[model samples]
Target: MVMEDMELERLSAAMDGELDDEKLPRLLGGCRHDPALQESWYAFHVIGETLRDPQLPPVRLHSRIAQALKEEPTVLVPKSSVGSVPLDGATQRRWLAMAAAIAVVVLTTALLRPSLPANPVIAQNGQSTPASTENGVSDRDIQTFVALHRQGSPLSEFQTVDYTPQTIAQR
Candidate 1:
């Protein structure tokens, strides 16, 4: 009796260690009772071993494989075009509605955002003053504040120490 092509394919896959875990036990159980499947399994292993080392004895398999191929039916059906199928009108409308809702939310958020002050307050001599005021902190005061800030910064602890060859020798 001719064995099914699927069984033969599974046997081949089992030999190659590519068979799924769920189907492996079923394939092994089939091999236990089926002599043809057992022979096919042995043949596949011999073929693998021969390929790995040409020095090993080669077994005739071409004729058996050719006979099997001749027995298998040829299928010429076209591949399914499931991916190319167009979306339904309702789906398209739903996607458009979602996009419109997101746009509305973004526009509303932007419109309702708090506006920044035209003339911000400037800290001058520990007192807050309107930047537009004549008595507001000058550029010199800003420079002094920045210098003080840098001096008090935590990273200022890593300040570079001036050294010379003479200083090293003295130490």
Candidate 2:
């Protein structure tokens, strides 16, 4: 068994073109007498050839596959019941009840939904006021708020200051 394994290893190395020249003659001699070694050599050559050219397959592979498929038993599947199955009286009534409940919920939601105002109201100082109206904030009020915000904001400190050669001479 060990000798057979060593022979297989040497045969594999030879197939890879890595075996010593001296051992090549002895390996070839063994392959002549040993049917298993001969099979291994043929298998290795076939594998190498297949790897070199993937488009071709073993000679009898297609025929063997066709024979295997022919020998296989045919499978018959039953038709699916799904929507074709008839529901019992109780089940039919339950389905009808569920459908009616869904319809009622949909209708109730559509009828009870609140209508939205044409113009959205803006809230200021806890009071709801229509924007761009007499009671709402005016342009002057907006400008005053913007000025106050700029004065109070920390970003106001980083404002760009104008510089001149006279200012630099003073510094």
Specify the highest-lDDT model's number.
2
Name the lDDT of candidate 2.
Answer: 0.47
lDDT of 1 by residue, 1-171 (tens): 355789998877765557775676677668656756766666665455434332232222322232222233322233565546565896667557546644554444334432323456544444543321211112223433433444456766236332221222233
Candidate 1 weakest ten by summed lDDT: 131-140
Measured against the true structure, the TM-scores of the candidates, in listed sequence, are: 0.29, 0.30
- Taking every candidate in turn, the Cα RMSD to the unseen true structure, in Å, is 33.8, 37.9
For candidate 2, lDDT tens digit of each residue in 1-171?
Answer: 698899999988876667776676677768656757866776665455434332232232222222222233223233655546566896667557555644554444334333323466454444533322221112223333444454466876237332221222243
Off by over 4 Å in 1: 1-3, 53-171
Give the Cα-based TM-score of candidate 2 against the true structure.
0.30
**Best-matching candidate per TM-score:** 2
Query: In model 2, what are the clashing residue pairs, if there are any?
Result: none
